[model samples]
Target: MQNLRRFILKYHFIILFILLEVISILLLANSQRFHRNRMVNTTNDVVGKVYEWSSEVGNYFRLNSANKQLAEENAMLRQQLSVVYDTTTCTYDIIKGDTLYKYIPAQVVNNSTNQVNNYIIINKGAKDGIERDMSVISTDGIVGVVTDVSRHYASIMSLLHSKSVVGVRFKNNQEIAGLKWQTNNYRYGMVEDIPTHIVLQKGDTIVTSSHSNIFPEDLMVGTVEEFYPTAVDALNKAKIRYATDFSTLRHVYVIKDLHKPELDSLKARLQ
Candidate 1:
């Protein structure tokens, strides 16, 4: 107790000076409008800077989610672009015709590509006019087709699966081939049955062919990464790097070709 009293006695003058300085500053700020305004502005500026910095940090953490959302939006835009009809390029004038293009935007509720027969689930169903054999695609490229459907959801056969195959062709030449993915690589596929007579180059764009009614012509699939002619046959097998990155897929658009049923029915009769 005696030591505590001695310590306070020794530093009392300095402490008193510090307290007096604080009180004098407060009095100056309260008495002078200019000083009060300056103090308030400085405090507000510091608080604002702190808030801004915190918000930036938060946004940086949420960038991945934001990018996924943007990818989904881009996919929807591409789907719309695929079906958009330009009257300037129309060769025949129509009297009273409904729009030929239709797309059903759906989110990927479930997806799997590592399996031999991979499949994807979308948040659409029979009630929404989705049916079997409908094409599914993302912003980057083709995804798959609707294989099954219920009242509120549908399943798709992803292109990444070994069992999945689609007709594809090169953009430059009309050389057509079948696009299939091996279970080994998820990012790419093999274009089989392309003849050696069709010259191919690296980075050549591949797109869906018009041979089938499942998907429309000119839908982008991927780019040619490598090509090798068969040792015995004249067919060339080209490795295609898929445009859609399967590891990060989120949203897709289901395409319903309204003329498909009529075309299929006519073909069946011919057969």
Candidate 2:
């Protein structure tokens, strides 16, 4: 404190001169219209830049919320697509005014792609209208099926799981087959039981078949990247490039079969 006082005393004259100079400049700027306008312009420019920086920072923080909102909007839009409204399956359930399928937007809170039984956890569950056996998909293609659910979260069997299987068909010829993960390669899946007469080409898209009531018809599953004409147990198989990138999956939609209870009831009578 004593040293600061001494320094202030020593430089009092210089400080006084600097202050007077600043004051005089301000007075001159205020008195002259041209100088006053320039000062105002300079101040406005600096303030505008500061506000712009602040706005950018705020937007950066809100990016997650923005993405979630967009996902929800997309889910609503998907619900309207003709593929989801399977008119052919409309039974008495239709007389009750129930839509065939509905989409529930969800955020992936956890995921695993390396393990043999890879699974995904989403930030939605029974409370959010999600349930067991519901189908999960990303913007690009199928991701998994719901296996379990809590009030606020649900577990999904990722398509990369060894036990996971989806009924898929070639988009061109409509030849159906079973798709499953046969190896640890998360980037690829496998399709088995390709029809004897069916021939596959490079990049042939595989889509979900109506047989899998869990998913809506024609949802993209994957594409055939390579074919193995060799048979295992007298069955033909092919390597399918995964349509959904499990490693980077973040957002997904859970599909609900509105008439599932009615369908299950009818199947139970057969049993």
Candidate 3:
């Protein structure tokens, strides 16, 4: 109270002058139609600006949750697609009973692109049904395969990893090959062992092949950017622009093969 009193005494003249000025301005504005209109417009303009800023700030804070919701919705929609389910009956007739895959929505908590064996960490883990060798993908394309998991988190072996390779095929001709990343560039990778006889062209779409049990067939991988012959073999290789940008990746869906256990058992028996 003493401090307040001292401050008021010290600035009394200045404060009174400001108050007088404000009163004079208000009186002038009230007396003149033009002044009053300008004052009203100025007040509205300031209030509108403050409201806009407040709205934008609120939206900024809500963006992350909104994105997570969208990712979950996308996972749901992807599960509903015909491609995720088998439509074949015993007689080669169309049926919709066989469900082949399930998508588990996850948020990318950590990721790396500039590494020999880059890995991605996701929010979903063993409890969410993420398992080793399960495929991870963005809405646009493949992201990686699940490698390690805890109760609430999982690690993904990113496609950008040097040892990583996905069995991809040309969308037009179904020519299968392996896509590998050694370029050390996250935006690009090479698909090698493409037979030279298979005519290659720029912008040719590449997709996951049935050869890979992990990823569903026909899932998009990337587009061919350039093609050239390898020195050792008659096979050709192509540089491709990856569909998923690892550098800015955020959301991913872990693909769970519904019949994976049966398939694994069959393979184990063969061995």
Candidate number of the best lDDT: 3
* Lowest summed lDDT window (length 10), candidate 3: 33-42
lDDT of 3 by residue, 1-271 (tens): 9999999999999999999999999876563432111223344345435544554565566688658857786677756754655434323433346978888988776677886668777767677877778999987799988876666667778898766779999999988999999747999999778887887889999999999877999998999999886667888879999998887776689998988899889999999
Q: What tens-digit string does per-residue lDDT give for candidate 2 at 69-120?
A: 5777677665664365754454424334656888898877667788777777
Error of 2 at 119 (Å): 0.8
What stretches of model 1 exceed 4 Å from their correct place? 1-98
Give the Cα error of residue 7 in candidate 1, in Å.
99
Question: Which run of 10 residues does model 2 get worst, by summed lDDT?
Answer: 33-42
TM-score of the candidate numbered 2?
0.65
Per-prediction CA RMSD (Å): 22.5, 21.1, 20.2
Q: What is the lDDT of residue 265 in candidate 2?
A: 100
RMSD of candidate 1 to the truth, in angstroms, is: 22.5
**What tens-digit string does per-residue lDDT give for candidate 1 at 146-235?**
876666667777887656778998999888889888788788899888987887899999999998567889999999999887778878
lDDT of each: 0.77, 0.77, 0.78
Displacement of residue 127 (Cα, Å) in model 3 is 1.4
lDDT at residue 141 of model 1 (Cα atoms): 85
Worst 10 contiguous positions by lDDT, candidate 1:
33-42
